[model samples]
Target: MTRLPKPKALLNKQWLVGLLFVPFMAMALPADRQQPIQIDSDTADIDNKKGVSVYRGDVVMTQGTTRITGDVITIYTRDRELTRVIAQGNKARAYYEELQPGEQGIVQAWGNTIRYDVDSDQIELIKNAQLSQKGDTFTGEKIDYNLTLQTVNAKGTPSQGDNGRVQMVIQPRQEKAASTK
Candidate 1:
């Protein structure tokens, strides 16, 4: 039998996790770059000459802690290096998630369509975009996230109804008390 961590320890862990969702400042796990990309789907069509690959029907692609799921996913490569990834959802929204460095939790995003640019390290979520980390969340019609710079730009279209409005929820941080001598 194993004993669980003390309540104080658990509280401290929660406190640390609170900052994991800080808007536009978390870094993705560096080791993920070294991992091989794995893709699974019901059907896949690869064209080496065009450097493009298309996967359909419950597609899932993963590299280390990074994962993407959608109904269709298209990958574009140049010189054998990934250049872009585009995911489109049919019945469900496209989903993406990646682990942050250190003790920070995973960052997740959902949208009708998602485009990722490898060279620029940027991700663009389109149509009912929603991003979340830890307990905090950002929702809008579109969201542009830069992983390298840790920045986010979101936009909303009023014509799309309630989801067209941009919304963000950030949790408050608990500061440690100063030690009295």
Candidate 2:
């Protein structure tokens, strides 16, 4: 009879031991909202602290309207709530949740290799990043937005923050224009 190697025998080397922990490391990472996510990548790194989560790699994560594809995705936690999120990559996109008018409240989204600081509730998008909501949109080299203040500040690039900023309102487009264009 043939027998597979014992579990202990497989993990004698330090490198092997470290390698063995990779899955547990990935599994131990805390993310209440990312379980149904699917990623396509060669490798990954996950860090979680005080409810905030960070994912790094050639990452492609998809969950319903939220799709974050980037080299890194950092999720911020506030009071144990998912207050802010950031994704950084070659390019990132998120179908940020929105609330219809008269429906009480709506959730907003920030997309493209982005960074979100939960304590400050700030969202930053980098490198070909774009933020859009309904018909409102902003595209630049990098974008910094404050969710609490309901304001947006964008720079042409990370280095040049003084060039100027654009302000906008997000709304649903007209039925005619949306279909044709």
Candidate 3:
């Protein structure tokens, strides 16, 4: 005859104590990792507890094709991965651009600077700064780049007459269509 083990012994069993596996857990992982183009700064202070990277003094930060240069650049991280980067420019301008893997271009911007936090997953464009992409340009008091959603937002007074404050012009790769003419 065999005797059943006590509750304490059964609870302590190694096999029973193994990690639980759930198929649904895979959905929790992120799809794309964060990769910046360039990070330039005179100083960089990292805080693991807060999961933030702060760069000061002539800081220029870029990710992939995006380029950001400012007096201060901050990078935010969550789960040991970088989530967002914000560049705070001086009287000078900061830059950011979205491009295909091999595409490259210059993104001109200027303002009080930029601040991005990982927890919020936002790229904040602030101050009297401006943002531009290709031929499109916008000048706003503040903007947010939502990484998760892959979208950009703007909020501020626009440039007069020219709509300098809020401008969006997507360049058409319409050469194929034009060739038919």
Candidate 4:
């Protein structure tokens, strides 16, 4: 059986799993970028000793302009700081809105599971991971996204057979003509 990481290790890097999954620039917005995160759920179980909390039944989390939703969410914290968040569902989803000057866009992601890492600031999407922004979309078995570097990596689960190939859709960039004086 695969052994789980120590609570400390899990708390530190596990969120990387989720953060790497989302390609939406908003999800990777700088630490100082957004407002405090808020979470809502039908039920929650906190284990102070283990530094873990689990939320079930329609979990929704919001921070600044970013939002993430899932059927179940498990959070790991250390010393009152969030370290990791794992969201799971038939189609766990995440959303982020950009309101920067001269920049306006929306990002959406969905997967069987989503993991967010606070320390390293990464996201990992597992099992049918999909991300979309500005009419662009990416789908694969797994996706890793780096919030800080604004980069994404994807992989397919070949062991599962033919449906496991990576797929992407990128829309052409629109150009404006310059007016001659």
Candidate 5:
């Protein structure tokens, strides 16, 4: 009689409030937050009286676990909230997956331009900005993140003469050795 298996349930905060959460205060999305904002585009343009919405070819967006791809994506809302969201592309990318209480994984970014600011949750990556988590990485031409103060601000643009300079790759933290039964 040996059967022990039941440990798979983490990722919360409503999928980090649709990814990384602007300011990530438990992953934003208030105002009764309803979720559901899937978008796929080959071409799209909506301007409900200038609320603004434009998606160009090869764009992809999700609203729950935060997934973003791009060729172009621009969304800006006002009274309805959602301040801004712009994603351009050559490599604009984004992803999300979070778990606290002991930490989990997944959080990525890449850019040719990727800005997402809901009031001020902030998430701006420009030029060749790159960001990662868990495995640690941070390259830059510009990268600003503050999803709930996880904090990060990188920049590099001396005309990119030497390819600028703002690169990081920290990944050395593994301490778990205390089990004696």
Candidate 6:
């Protein structure tokens, strides 16, 4: 059996708390939500009655700095407003990336399937889910991230490789040098 790192040895509790809460406090740029969404794909099928649209063949969707790319993407709208987005990957993993508020850098996620709910401000990654920000990484079978709550929940499935354990890698913060007076 593989040994897991002790909680105390894994990461600094205070730093871990801040790592999980601080940067994600503003998961995306405030203006991103206000920006108009743009999508590009080889083909698109829209069903006005159902308020559903499906795009196939290298679909790319963007709103400000937030971008999602996949082999197929489905968008759901309600009353002309976007309600949800689902992306499924065939040749490659579905990918999502967005610039965080301030200079926190970009957050990126990848999985076989990605689901984003606009109302709840949540993103769910299923199957080979992996998320990373500022060099820290999280990997598991499934990951649910709530932007508003700044929380993350991950589930792992037993397999040959990882032994059904979620993995996290937290990088040490770099200290700035003092200026000479």
Q: Could you say which candidate leads in TM-score? A: 6
Clashing pairs in 6: none
For model 6 the TM-score comes to 0.87
Candidate 3: 10-residue stretch with minimal lDDT? 19-28
Using all chains and alpha carbons, the TM-scores for the candidates as numbered come to 0.82, 0.45, 0.55, 0.73, 0.31, 0.87
List, residue by residue over 20-96, the lDDT tens digit for candidate 2: 22221111122424546555655645445566566666665554434556677666555555666666654435323
Shift of residue 63 alpha carbon in model 4, Å: 1.2
Query: Model 3: per-residue lDDT, tens digit, 13-123?
Result: 422222121111111113223563366777889899998888888876655545567777778777877767766666566554444222223444456766655566555
Top-down TM-score ranking: 6, 1, 4, 3, 2, 5
Each candidate structure's count of clashing pairs: 0, 5, 16, 17, 3, 0
| Candidate 5 local lDDT, 1-181, one digit each (tens) | 5534323342233223224332222343332135777899988988878899998888887776566778888989887666888888864344332233224345678878888886787888887888776766777788787766666767677655546756666665579999999
- Ranking 1 against 4 by lDDT, winner: 1
lDDT by residue (tens digit), candidate 6, 17-121 = 435533543568889889999999999999989999999999999999999999999999999899999999999999999998776888899999999998999
Cα lDDT tens digits, model 4, 112-140, are 88888878878788887987777767788
Q: Using lDDT as the measure, what is the rank order of every candidate, best first?
A: 6, 1, 4, 5, 3, 2
**What are the per-model C-alpha RMSD values against the true structure?**
11.7, 22.1, 19.7, 10.0, 15.9, 3.4
Q: Highest lDDT, which number?
A: 6
Q: Model 6 Cα RMSD, Å?
A: 3.4
**Could you tell which candidate, 2 or 4, scores higher by TM-score?**
4
Model 5: weakest 10-residue lDDT segment is 17-26
Worst 10-residue lDDT window for candidate 4 reads 95-104
Candidate 4, overall lDDT? 0.69
